[model samples]
Target: MDTTKIEKNFKKLTSSNKIFESVLMIGNASGDFNFTREYKRDIDTPMLMASTTKLLTTTCIYALVQEGKLNLKDELSNYLSKEEISGLHVFKGKEYTFELTIEHLLSQTSGLPDFYLTGTKPVFSKVKDRDFSYSFEEELEWIKHMKARFIPGTKRKAYYSDVNFDLLGKIIEAANASTLQEAYEKYIFSPLNLKHTYLANTESDFIPHTYYKDQRLYRPLFIRSCYASGGGVTTARELMIFIKAFWKGELFDKTFFSKQAQSNPLQMSFYPIHYMGGYMKITASYPFGKKYTLVGHSGSTGAFAFYCLEKDLFIVGDVSQIASPSTGVRLAMRTVLAAE
Candidate 1:
């Protein structure tokens, strides 16, 4: 890779002609090789992370496990299923189907319907009682109303649903006697000193109206993200600090870290990144052995941030210049992997 041209393009990408606002930060964990091109502002600004909150959900569950508050194998009903579920299967209308387990839920194998669509059922439903407002608890209730689409733990199809993390979030709170926000603050964000990163309960403080234009990536103007899971907000520097510490086995146990690596396999991969519980792992294939696991997740809703450990690097910013998840990584992968 031509670092010089990439650098030049980095500057061009931040230019107003190609973008309205931009921030790109790339650097190693050990205070090495820090570079940034940002016409928008500094690296400390906050951007919504979209689905990256899944990683936080995983860490929160891990904390519960550490505290002996949860066992992953326990059934969903054993812990947090508030609605009356006699078996794994609940009778909806007239159909009595199979059960949904907590393991299935965590592994994305529950066969539950996507909460984004079903949870937003009012948009598709005419029934009034079925109507539900957007909130953390309501999101969980939405999952309670769903039946497995297939036999739980059997189907492998990818269903990127916020309900997955929402369930995990519920697990954290139910086990800890607190909300997901509090649990996250206590177990993960606070202990690690991630003062800037937050699993937001509201967007009142941030996500203001702004104007930006970048052709390569899509980003929305100031708006609010519905309550579910994912869509967190944070800065690149804070994300990097978290990633570097997590990657080096300093923040978590070594044995668990290795298993965490195993949590992601080739099948779960989505090109530039692979899915592990909720976090996305990206390995650098272009430069041969420049493999890195991007410990954070990317949001389709205009925010992508990562803590890359292979390079001891953490890169957070909008590649599109506006408030959009950077398409740079995918664009790089496509250039190398796609056929002419």
Candidate 2:
């Protein structure tokens, strides 16, 4: 690997692009590949990881299953005896309690309302100390009150609901008798020796800060209180490390990983998340054949990333811009296949 060319390419990437701030590293998870690594300033400075947090939730669920503390098929109502889980008439409706389950949350099949439904924006914008928060119990409570548009588990649409991961967070907590943050920290972060990666619920001051107005919307490092399971905060190094480790069979049973890799036909896949789980699997397209089957995930909003597993050990430069990193992923493929 030519350091000069790599550095030149990276410099060109960040210099020309509007990278708000990012940190990234790419290499082999199991000692097979190590390419250019750039973990520069403000990179991985503990920004919000957004939907990539779902992968984290998935890991926690699998761990509980592996430990026999939770079952995918078990009804979630069995654990919570509160008013929300009861089949009684609570929501001015019938016994509307048959639509909830653990797998429903895991597969996004709970028929739960999408997060975008509640738009209090005009009022929310006027408030100063309005921290963006969504409670798990309240969401489930809403589900209890709300009627399903369709039966659960019939369709596999990629409905973006924070409630899905929030429920999984609850399930993880119930299975371990600990907070989702504790379970994630103890099982995943700590084991990986990942300093920059903190569970959403874990409070930390060093996670960096971002601003919206004078109010400072949410502390970039301290936001897990509400959106922990779905949109966790993390850095480039941490994200890359976790992705590589999980993909390389360093963390769990190969069989389970394979199971996770199974594609969801009902949902259209996107860059870096071609298959699902920790990544997307791409086989080929009219543009790039075979090499296009790159596996990875893109989120942690305003940030784009890719990691090549089968073709070349690679990680791309991070950009905290509005555009998704798919464009860059396509360009980088040309470099990875240069017959090094």
Candidate 3:
């Protein structure tokens, strides 16, 4: 594949706006056909994974399933105490907290409101002004005051909630009898030989500052608090390895993906993006004329890890800009079109 266009677009976009630093790596399923580009940051620079960490959480969950430690059909109450989950999903005056299943959470059909983006007090808006940390229990308390979007397992309806994966992180711990970080090490990072990828757990973990427009915000406490939902750190080079493993069944059985293949359209704010299992799926057809699908996820910090199925291309990168989360997605799409 001629990467002239890819290189040109990368330089053009990185040099233009709020992107403080950026790195990209594009490659085929095979080891050959590799191309990488960087602007103000090297390929090995550690960057926040943001919501793309959901893919890592998803991989670990599947690993537990393979180990017979958990089941998709298991109830949330089976792992979490009733007091902890009760009144968490009361929609239309009916309590649906006990009705939530692992499948529902994994598929983003749990009707849970996002603590980071929803409620009278959303953490997102305050993130730019200041930096602070809250425990998982605090997050649950925040969500309890919020309203659920729909009933659990509502047909064709999906809401993007960070709490879903946050809950999954708890379930993984409950089932495996270990910390989420340990599970990740055993099932993902260690197995993949990834030295730089890690779940940020403490002030010592070295969480990088993300650009929220022109202001650089260093929220180590908040990033560590993200936990399973979006608290991962990795380099562009390592992310490329993990994403390829994720789609190739190296972390878990690829066949399990078929069960979660059916995707549902998310809320309008996430237009042109769909929720499938634990990741985001994008089907590009309009404007470009050719319909092709990209499977994987994008992050609020302008991080992206996706595979263009038709092109057999794995695209991994980070723009490190929180104000324009979709920047990485648009870049990936342009790279896909350029590769052709």
Which candidate number would show the highest TM-score if scored against the true structure? 3
lDDT (Cα, tens digit) per residue for candidate 1, span 35-78: 66566556787755556566667666766776788876766666
- Scored by lDDT, model 1 comes in at 0.54
Q: Candidate 1: lDDT of 148? A: 47
- Measure candidate 3: CA RMSD: 1.1
Task: Identify the leading candidate in terms of lDDT.
Answer: 3
Error of 1 at 239 (Å): 1.9
Where does model 2 exceed 4 Å of error?
Answer: 1-13, 36-44, 85-97, 116-130, 141-150, 200-204, 210-222, 260-262, 265-288, 303-309, 312-318, 321-340
The local lDDT score (0 to 100) that residue 266 gets in candidate 3 is: 91
lDDT of each residue in 224-329, candidate 3, tens digit only: 9999999999999999999999999998988887876579999898888989878889986658588888999999999999999999999999988888899989
For model 3, the stretches where C-alpha displacement exceeds 4 angstroms are: 286-288
TM-score, candidate 2, is: 0.72
How are the candidates ranked when ordered by TM-score, highest leading?
3, 2, 1
lDDT of each: 0.54, 0.54, 0.90
Select the stronger candidate by TM-score from 1 and 3: 3
Tens digit per residue, CA lDDT, model 2, 1-340:
4445555555665565344344445565455655544534544466666556666777777777777888778876766664655642222343434446677666655445443333333212322245454456655555554444335554444333556677667777778999777888876898898887665554433444433322234443225544544446677767777776665556655466566535543233242333344334544344553454555544433333455556546463444432343434543444444324
